[model samples]
Target: MSKTVFITGTSSGIGRETALYFSENRWNVIATMRHPESRKTGLEGRKNIDVIHLDVLDPDSIQQAVTHALTTYGSIDAVVNNAGYAAFGPFEASTPEAVRRQFHTNVEGLMDVTRALIPVFRRQGHGTIVNVTSMAGRMTFPLYSLYNSTKWAVEGFSEAVAFELRPFNIKVKIIEPGIINTSFYDRSKDVLSTKEITAYDTLVEKIIRYEEGNIKKGKFSPPSVVARTIYKAATDGSWKLRYHTGKYSGTILGLRRVLPERTFIGMMRYLTLR
Candidate 1:
């Protein structure tokens, strides 16, 4: 029987790309999203792909999607937790609700999904959990404190969990992508704002403008690169845990590892805030 993979956040971006890649490669794909109805026509024609409703924020949906996928394919070889968005801008301006929601979706939601599927993985005695974190998880940038925090959480969580899951024949992998050219910049990001506080306005504007310029220049890699990396993580049949993708992901991470803490911080401030 062909292997099956269950993925979340397939409405667009990395998740959509991953689903398509796996499907084209002949793996059965459980492509899930909050609005699966909207995707019916597009993915329904594909024999090996099943589009289903699964909002990470909804525990019921999580259980439902997992159950359906297992029954449909008889086995789930992997689960890709790729459903997350960013809450950007200055931290001080971020609302309490926004902060909570950010963690709810990025950190807590991913945790819930993993928790729901571990039993199935244990029963089968083997499975893979691929988390789509970000380069920001390891390195910080201006105006993305909260989003960075969530990715860091995922990174730390995955790293620690890998050791525990090792004996269970389950593997955890983290995919870190840097500056991917997805709808993420325009549609999937939320910028925090304090209506009356203008202290960080000019600085935030400059940072946003700089990022937009980089994206417009096509400096970021396409989501397919990350999808390919994810596929490798799924099928590599090794205990490897981290896969970095997109442009400058390795270089930035390498520099951060080798450079002095103060030197790196100073360099980032000069490049972004200057």
Candidate 2:
């Protein structure tokens, strides 16, 4: 029987690419997103793929999606937690509501999805969990306080859970992708701001200009790169924990580890504002 993968946030970007990749590789794919009837990803009507509605913020939807996948496929080999959004800008500029939403969607949502699938995975006696985080999980940049915190939370959570899940023949993998060319650069990004906060305007402007300059020069990898990496992580069958993908992921991770804290902060400031 063909292996099955349940992936969240499959409406576009890495999620959509991963769903397609799995389908092409002959794996049954449960490609779920918040809006199934409103997406243009063409995941629907594809062989070996089922597009379903799954909003990470909706607990009932998470359960329903998992149930549907298990019912249709008998067992799921892996679950990819790819549903998340980023809130960027100064910490002070981020409203309490935005902060809550960021953590709820990126951190709690991932946990909720994983929690729902753990029982099924435990019952099946084997499974893989691939969490889609960003390089920001380990390496922080300016104007992404909330976003970085959320990814970092996923990183820590995945690391800690891997130990417990290993005995059940389940593997937890973290996909730390670097800058990728996707809707995340625009549509998926929430630029946090309030009318009262003009203090961060200059700093945020500098960071945005610097980042945009690099983006225009094509310094990022395509979403397919991360998708392919995810496929490898899910099927590698090793206890390996972290899989870095996309442009500059490995290099940046290395820098973050070896550089002094003060020096690293300076370097990031230079790279993000220069």
Highest lDDT model number: 2
Candidate 2 residues 74-144, lDDT tens each? 99999999988888888988788999999999999999999999999999999999999988999888888
Regions of candidate 1 where Cα sits further than 4 Å from its true position: 39-41
lDDT of 1 by residue, 100-135 (tens): 999999999999999999999999999999999998
Q: Can you give the TM-score per candidate against the true fold?
A: 0.97, 0.98
lDDT score for residue 218 of model 2 = 96
- lDDT assessment of candidate 1: 0.91
Runs with alpha carbons beyond 4 Å of true place in candidate 2: none
Report backbone clashes per prediction: 0, 0
For each candidate, the alpha-carbon lDDT, in order, equals 0.91, 0.92
Instruction: Estimate candidate 2's alpha-carbon lDDT, on a 0 to 1 scale.
Output: 0.92
Which candidate number has the best TM-score?
2
Distance from true location, Cα of 9 in model 1, Å: 0.5
